[model samples]
Target: MMGRLTIRDRSLLRDGVKAIVSGDVEHLKQIVLTMGVHSGRIDHARLYGDIDDFLAKYAKLDLGSMDLGQIIEELVGLAREHRISVPKGISMLSRGVLTLEGVLAVVSPKINLLEILANRMSAEIRKDFDWIEEQKGRFRNLYESSQKGIRIPAQMSDLLRMALKGQAKVNLEVIGSEQPLASLDRMVNRLVKCILCAAMLLGSCLLCTTGMQPKLLGIPLVGMLGFIAALLMGIWVLWDMHKHK
Candidate 1:
């Protein structure tokens, strides 16, 4: 006979569901182990056995036959039979896995399994390549420590180490490249010149509208000709800046 789930079981189920939805396998594993210890339904030995059984079942199937939805339905039925309360957001976890599977289907058949798993993990973590690079230093340190026998899986540790090394290599290349200050200075100068030109053109327009005939060398500055010339200069400056860019 199945036992009734307690409040603790519900809480652990919620956490496990969240981890699944987020694609956080590490957290999921931890939750599973904790739940097993608490309920005596999924100890370490049973966990390994379950994994082996799952893999063995799927090993004979092709990609098309891997019906995730059917598998989830079966799991839900089993949970019900066991008198376990299914966690909320279980649908979200299913959707996330289905999305990952869809992505894998579009990729090259020859794509490495490790790469595919890494991609799925990244999707679950909601982290991008740029974010990884930004935290490269911290990750590098963690990777080094993980080499000394961290509790994380070997594949995950290797992936983290690779990301850190890749980011470091990119940073080194950027540091060795030519400085961009000269280009930045040129851009600032161009922007300043454009603003000055625009200001002059606006001032000329104001003078013309106010019927003030400002002149330079008696050429009737701030008249139609002056406004036109200033406007032309502003446009030319903007065009020049665009060309430089």
Candidate 2:
């Protein structure tokens, strides 16, 4: 009864107990076991496995005298150790719900250090990008200053002006058949994309704050997935705009 259990087995026992307590007969019937020793009958094989010993131990327990709250706490601990998803009600059975940071503090302090390092790295990368843009702008200003007072021959200037005007008319025609609907549509699409990306980023941050279960690298899996999706979509949107521009 008291031995190491895999995530799948832990999930099975946790759900089974929840179902029993909630009177969810349908869910109890749906529980299936694919691993363990095989036998001619499924029930017989289940009885032959370590699950049988666990059930036996629980069956012998005097429920009338035992503390149900403590039992729930133990189950919750098992669920957390295995990273199995626990129901909200079961999570609230304990005195308090521990946040992700709290769990990290209990599990390992190194996880907190890693989180701080990740934050610092992202900040450094942002600073580097900003510096590059600043350098580019400085160089552009220097080049523009150097080009001042440069004069072109009148004939060449006239030809250049006419060519630019013709090109502008052509570009305007391409942008609009009869109306500015094409430009409007492009603007609307970009706006919509920006809104969606912003929402995704916001949602990702909210999910991280939730401290939901099934984490990846100490971060909520939902938040990680949301952030990754937002990043890919943002990159795609930027590339599309740059290509069109």
Candidate 3:
């Protein structure tokens, strides 16, 4: 008969689940090895060897696309291979406290669970490439300046001095870099032009309704001029959009 898991067993299972969820294979391997030794069975010696082999194989694998369920199933299989009986769908508890299976049940619902992991890996790669390119640019600048038998540029010398003294400011801005708010400024300009066009059109319509104006062909002269202005502004707005596109 299977015995209820002790507090230590529950803690080990919790750590194992945490490691699996975090994609930390090394920690999971250590946890599994500890669990195997704690079992105190003679045959568990082989389980230790199996864990080592498992770690070596997974060390080179692309874990970003691997499903968490597959790893859990592999662990369960290892237990079975070592003659360790795992109670299937059986809760040995009156309080319904969560066990390994319970945690797995909650975590295994997402079919695309590893999609976020893949995205994170991609982001990390992009950051690494960016850092490398930045370092290359700094080194190239230094090399070019040295070849000319001249002191480094004032900005570069200042930066190096500040860095060496550990007083470098984080908010330094490069002179030729594009402004962060450039897009926002363009959006605001477009919105302002739209508002001006709309105001002109509404004023023209209102002017046409008024009788107090200089008459021009049974219409107010100011109203006619207003209409012409509004039309020209509308055309200008459309032309600006087309040109930008």
Candidate 4:
């Protein structure tokens, strides 16, 4: 006696066939979506045009029968034509173990153009895989919900508290003082002034001892000239100091 297939058996058979037939199409759609997202501002015309062109070119060929490597290579070439950059590591990976969600996880460590592609791919994968929803719920419960009340270590907690309370102090002490340089500068200035004064005084005394015949207002002309030069030098030094200040 021939037995008729039950509704459950028919449904299982239909799902199996649908999965097989739609696998390549789903993957291609995911790749296109990822590229659009990564490109930031999607050019809808370019995107749709490319997909339509690809479909038309490969319409005669069974996409499911094509190896994943070849498919990825074609996709990479397409992305390059459109100015999209795919990671070298991702392109090099074998297709047998690669999944849209797996690729997303591998590349989504940071927020970047690549991350946008990863997220888009992940969304596409989720659309195909209903089980991901259940997994996401469990992950959120274990990580997101629980993380809110996570306890910090005592040392770290105390440090954070101190910072929040504005009680944290950073003491910075200079290793050496600049007083020595200032003292040396003052000593040098005084020594220069004393040398100039002594030179002027000695010259004036020598001129006076010589008792030159030429006199200026009853003063020895040479001695008087030396005194005038000394006064000018003092004025110059004071002017220089004031100018600098």
RMSD after CA superposition, every candidate: 23.0, 33.5, 22.7, 24.8
Q: What TM-score does candidate 3 get on C-alpha atoms?
A: 0.29
**Candidate 4 global lDDT:** 0.58
Q: Between candidates 2 and 3, name the one with more favorable lDDT.
A: 3
| Per-residue lDDT of model 1, residues 30-90, tens digit only | 6545554233242344444453454456557654455554445444443443344454445
In order of appearance, the predictions have TM-scores of 0.29, 0.28, 0.29, 0.26
* Model 2 lDDT at residue 75: 46
User: Once superposed on the true structure, which residue ranges of model 2 sit more than 4 Å away at CA?
Assistant: 1-179
Give residue 27's error in model 1 in angstroms: 7.6
Q: What digit string (tens of lDDT, one per residue) describes model 4 on residues 1-245?
A: 12344555444333322333344444454455543325544444565566556655555655333334444566667766766665544354424224543564478623233234345555766787768788988998989756665654666799889999999999984433345677679668866985796699689878887768798876698899888888887787777566755
lDDT string for model 2 (55-90, tens) is 444555543433344445654554343334454444
The prediction achieving the highest lDDT against the true structure is: 3
lDDT of 3 by residue, 49-88 (tens): 6765655555565545455455556776776676655444
Q: Poorest 10 consecutive residues of model 1 by lDDT? A: 168-177
**Lowest lDDT block of 10, candidate 3:** 89-98
Could you tell me how far off, in angstroms, the CA of residue 4 lies in candidate 2 after the best superposition?
86
lDDT of 3 at 79: 65
Q: Give candidate 1 regions above 4 Å deviation.
A: 1-41, 76-85, 91-127, 131-245
